[model samples]
Target chain A: MLTLAQAQTIMTTALAHAQSAGFKPLTIAILDARGAQKLFTAQDGTSLKRGEIAIGKAHGAVAMGIGSRALHKMALERPYFVEAATHAVGGSLVPVPGGVLIRDAAGTLLGAIGVSGDTSDNDEAAALAGITAAGLVGDTGA
Target chain B: MLTLAQAQTIMTTALAHAQSAGFKPLTIAILDARGAQKLFTAQDGTSLKRGEIAIGKAHGAVAMGIGSRALHKMALERPYFVEAATHAVGGSLVPVPGGVLIRDAAGTLLGAIGVSGDTSDNDEAAALAGITAAGLVGDTGA
Candidate 1:
């Protein structure tokens, strides 16, 4: 189980990575394995919709049991996949680059994290860094 | 009508109840009648998944007009019901005991609350206590 403390630490580290990279203010959302929300916060100056976007990404990752990066790739190759997932997950499946899953040392899926604010690549980089900082593995969705 | 203050109070009191019982850390989420998020937070040591479970429970309760405990019981009696709900609701329904409906003295539904992290029974107890503390009615979904 990825405790809230770990989730917060991951989020904080993710934010720091974004700041270090000179990215814009970001919104972060994390969910447990059961798709429960463990943590969420939006940096000041970010658009209101960033939170929803973050949630969409995180939920998409959780529901599909894959990273958003993978979903993004599939969506790019097959647009219908996005539509189907959106319909299936209540429009929360955002095929983006920032949503990734957290895995423990034994390769257990602990939860997911989504980041928004910067470009998709930047957001993803920040999120991956955050997961690594939390001593968990972050898949690239490949 | 549900205010953010009231939502926060309910979540806070819910956590207090869990703490009083020496239960595990928890996450709490509340939404208004329209299913808009009112407030959410996780205890320090709780898992990240608790928040999402709480949300699913709360959303499930609101969408079904019954407590999650009721859904849980129904799910036990009818397994296919869970699949149908997941499809109809876009996968947010969680047939768990932690989701409960909040009503006013006049029996008007103000919103719903979802709690997670501890055992389902403990989560339900904490959520009900919080509702009572907020001077609202907490339906047990029976």
Candidate 2:
């Protein structure tokens, strides 16, 4: 039951982290536990494609119940899974490092956040900061 | 142009209208001009089905460049067209009521809004109220 306000707080903080780090403009997507989109924003100047890619990353994280960083690693070690998963979601799945799950103090899965428009690692870093700033945990699979 | 604040305002007001009208819990979806989802929220007690249906309605309205009311009428008059269009979008299209386009004063397409819960007429009424409340034009097609 992550409220929309909470999602916005998390996403805004994520964008701020990107800003502070001098990262390029980023797009952020948030999805609730049901895999329903809660919020999405592509900051000014981001590429036209960033919104969908960011959303795909977040949707993938939620669908797999794991952070996208882990998926990226798995994709590297077992590329076949990536191909199959991508097709399974009708091309909405993205195996990347920018998607992360948000959890409560009790380790309940609330939702996920995905950031795009920078290096995958950097995008993950921003998402991590945002998740923490909103008083939640981000499972980066680290 | 449609700012996130404006989108939020519209969605919140739509929910309020539903609340006032004593309608069932509703879900709302807002999309930017490029058909990128900007915001989506399901009220506390809405059915799980509302989430996807709400999104589908909004996506369809944007793809067709008109309000869902018009699409609904078209579906009644030309069922085959709706079938082909739905299949075309990989089944994301919902040619039903409750989706409307937002436009600026100069008639520029800003985005679209979708609401689900209660009857289709009620949903469209709430969406239109929200559009008007936010000072945007809704292409309800009458």
lDDT of 2 by residue, A77-140 (tens): 9999987987887787778899999999899999898888899999999999989998999997
Model 2 residue A107 CA deviation in Å: 2.1
Checking candidate 1 for backbone clashes, the offending pairs are A32-B49, A36-B52, A36-B53, A37-B51, A37-B52
lDDT of 2 by residue, B53-124 (tens): 998889898888988888888899999998899888778777788998999888999989988888998998
Q: Please, what are the lDDT tens digits per residue for candidate 1 over residues A1-142? A: 7786688789779988887889997878888787777777666565636678988888899899999999998998999978897998888888989999999989999989988889999989998998999989997596
Model 1: per-residue Cα lDDT at residue A40: 70
Provide all candidates' interface root-mean-square deviations: 5.1, 2.9
Query: How far out, in Å, is residue A4 in model 2?
Result: 4.1
TM per model?
A: 0.59, 0.86
TM-score of chain A of 2: 0.96
Model 2 bad stretches (over 4 Å): A1-5, A19-23, B20-22
